[model samples]
Target: MKRRDFFKKGTTAALAAGVVPIIASSCATSKAIIDDRKKDKWYHLGTGKKAIPERKITKDFEVAVIGGGAAGICAAVASARNGSKTVLVQDRPVLGGNASSEMRVHLNGVNSIKGKAERETGIIEELLLHNRFENEQESYPVFDHVMYDFVIREPNLTLMMNTQAVEAIMDGNKIKSAKCWQATTETLFTIRASIFIDCSGDGLLGASAGAEYRTGREGKAEFNETYAPDEPDGWQMGATLLMSSKDMGRPMQYSPPSYAIKYTHEDAHPRRSFKWFQDGIWWIEVGSKGDIIADAEVNRHKLMGYLHGVWDYIKNSGNFPEAENLALDWVGSLPSRRESRRFIGDYIVSEKDMTEHKHFNDAVAYGGWSLDEHNPGGIENISEPPSYFHYHFKKIYEFPFRSLYSKNVSNLMFAGRNVSQTHIALSSSRIMATCALMGQAVGTAATICNKKGVLPRDVAKNYILELQEQLIRDDAFIPNRPANDANDLTKSASLIFCSTTTSGDAKNLLNGISRDIDGNINHWQSDGLNAEVQLEWETAVEISTVELKCDTNVKRNIMMRKDSKNDELYGNHVPIEMLKSLSVHGRVNGKWQDLGTIEANRTRLIKFNFKPSKVTAVKLKLKDTYGAKNIKLFEVRCYA
Candidate 1:
């Protein structure tokens, strides 16, 4: 049954079971109350029946993910897939957060590092690739539904849209339940869970739970951050209002709305030049000095005015004949936010940690995006550059698990912009795809928390290695970390060999690294198609699953761009280098037997499962790629 269909027919489902109070009619007081209820219904033309509808629901789950953005989505999905009963609560009707239809910010990760993208894999990559086939039209609204389908299809996940988790019911220092207000149905949801992850960007749930947090820039002396302000201040980074324009075949007349603010090129910063104005301008923004969340509405109004004023200059200024035929197609009323509510965790990620590439024993995720911090005053400060693209990472840096959970609130954790990070560190790590990685990490950690009945701090302190291993097993890349899962039988193979050699050695597949990075190759590329890689065990081993991490060209991005850019840095379609067709075979009693074959594959991590068989040798027959002539594979694993 559809999850939301409980209101219609599946009301008896245990999770959404209704507990409405009906008149018992056993006493005079009850009869009097029933008479009043009947009188109230009679006032409504008797269509409302005998009782007032109860607009509240109480449910239980193992994990509760607050926010439906990239981070929250990843967190909820990971929690569910990792064996936790998870609930995904989104404030808006659609998912994707800033990248949603309301605010069309692109989902960016380690977009470019020295001209090559150390692109994210795992859930984020899977979502983008799903959009490649499902949202080929590249419409933001359609992409929203694509994300909706992805989350709801997971059997263990429950999605609640248009629900805002506003209040936290606390049990001492831990959050026992979240009082979420669903706007659409006027129903309040009390979601009880053992673990609570706040990825809502603004982090209302954590704040209500008394999670220690701070806002605005930190003083340089605090963390010795070169990019930090001279002294601490309440100057937080701002939000942006985006708009798109389309060109008509003929000249289109233009008029500015009355509320539009007047604009001239003379006052704006030189860096704010219209580079990709055909899509949406990113510099049209505003920031706050105090509480940014409280000022969201006031700032949103000003942003809409500024957006139209800029469009007026483009459409009617007559400064450029090229824009005469162009007309505004989409203007966003909602502003895409950047910074607010930095929760305090055991370890606060500072500028130097990212710049100097500080190693963390509990690193569970990695990021390489440039430290692109926007100007303090945002577009309001016309003299300053829109953003300072501070330091670009030459290589990826580790993100610690200690920076993801609350330092004071025992049960609260965070995964998005609200995570424990100095403002300078957030400048780089706030990218959506990077946040998605953090989400996946914390989500997986939530499952461990449930299994052991521990808090987030305990997981970081003691069970970190187990958490890292599970993350690697789930395909999340952590810098300087390699998988050493003892159950993987390929590492125990007596010999590993390849039929052909063109680039990397087949032995590298057992090295535990899944991707080539830092100018090093961990992959084995066949000189030609129809190649084979064989693993021989000294003794017959029982196995039922073989997994391969094939190349999907992580050096280039595949996320949907506003312009649908298909260039060297980005691809509009599937990666041609991906292994499209492959078959696994096993040798039993010195005779080869078919294990499994996949004709059309879509994900970078491909798996083949069959009945367990004891085989002395196993071979992988690599056939074709999506387009490339030769196929490349980074790692392989066999498990019973």
Candidate 2:
């Protein structure tokens, strides 16, 4: 059954089960009493009913993320990890937006377009790596739980699922609180935060907070974008209803609904590709002529009709005999939207910024997806291609921090597709993985703003270098910017190695680059493992933090999936070269003392912090790797 039909039938049963209070004949209250009671409390009488008991909750956090998609997930995680209390509010029961079980769209990122070298790192990579270790089936629903696990593991993050952020309480130009309503439990949530991130693809939080925004396409002359129309038009990309089919090994009959649209071979002419039918159908789309946000239900209804119509055509049109045993495995109830309101920011990114690779001083994130603009006419345009691809990038282009915060709303910031970018640039930057990078950048910035008692724009203007450095320290990679740890004791202290490999230098550990940078430098290799590296200070130095960046084979794919093709972005297992066992020792009272021991470490970056100790020297002893025969490391740093 469709999700809507199930909800309708379930509501009736829930009412019968006393889930909703009904007026009883024994306690018939007078009209005046009912009106008086209604004045004080919000309730539904004979006119309407509610399922769960109503309640209200008010809480405060450092950051509040108003969506649970890839961008929101990363934003919440990054903020929480950066020493801020964070809350993640998602309307749906699951996370991942279009990549969830409801839609089944693949999670595409920099890897999808730019290749392995530029694959997005940080929270998104950690989640992907976690999914690889925990989920083996590669099922959509399992992926949902994987995302849930990723959020719940963070002690500083609170996950509020099945909660819709319906209203925004504003205090002048800043958002005071986000009013959310939960239909399943009938609970209202008033979340107050110092900073707010609207990763919602629709930019609903920004809209409710009165943030300046733009919708639809821009004129060519406005930004000198060749792909745009000569005159401005209120035509945006349509939302799609994805579907999946599986072979049942037996023929199954399909009956069309009365609302289903009729289709013929001539209707789907040259643009249709229906030969394979196991995954998402990207073309069953609608909603370009109407207000996508206000008329979402209307567009969703049309998309359902188009989806059913296309499925009926595949089954009964006698197009392919192979589809005789094929059955519709699943269909998304909600429309996965593509374009909507894009909040205006300090600087708006244009098509030329992406196409010409324009440089920005505040570039924090990067993307390389080709400019993929779907036709506004959708299924109605039979002769035109489903989407027009204007150009591809030679390398990943940078996205600036200036284009991520509101122009007017002081404490408001956003990521995902709603970030400050023209329609032409958004066409390329709207990919999920690219949005994940932007989310991480903004989330990190939000935490810093909260700690330093400043606004997002102020951080962008004054503390951009600090934000970029923090992101790099947390495993995020920014092109053209090399890592430099000024606090590293190795930069000033003496370095010594017990042994060396044929082509490895112990001094490369202080070079600062973490991962493989264009397959050149910033890494040291020791053959045959069981190597030792030591740093000696002439005078006892106060030290409290130690960081290590190990090699994780960035050139290969580590994403989890059943398909083991080397060419694909996702693979079957973790990288073999990661450090598995290691030990550290520090000189205390003229004797070496064990500081810490790590076994079976999986992440590429690891850090250990302890009470401040005056140590004369520190030593690192490496034992084994997950699979590699040699010990390879990128950089190591000690901060006092």
TM-score for each predicted model, relative to the true structure: 0.92, 0.87
Per-candidate Cα lDDT values, in order, are: 0.86, 0.78
Q: Which candidate is the best by TM-score?
A: 1
lDDT (tens digit, per residue) of candidate 2 on 315-411:
8988767779988888887788888888999999999998888888798888888898876767756446677778877677889999999999999
**Total clashes in model 1, counting residue pairs 3 or more apart in sequence or in different chains:** 0
Model 2 gets an lDDT of 0.78
Off by over 4 Å in 2: 1-54, 114-116, 250-253, 265-271, 496-505, 528-533, 556-568
Best by lDDT: 1
Query: What is residue 383's positional error in candidate 2, in angstroms?
Result: 1.6
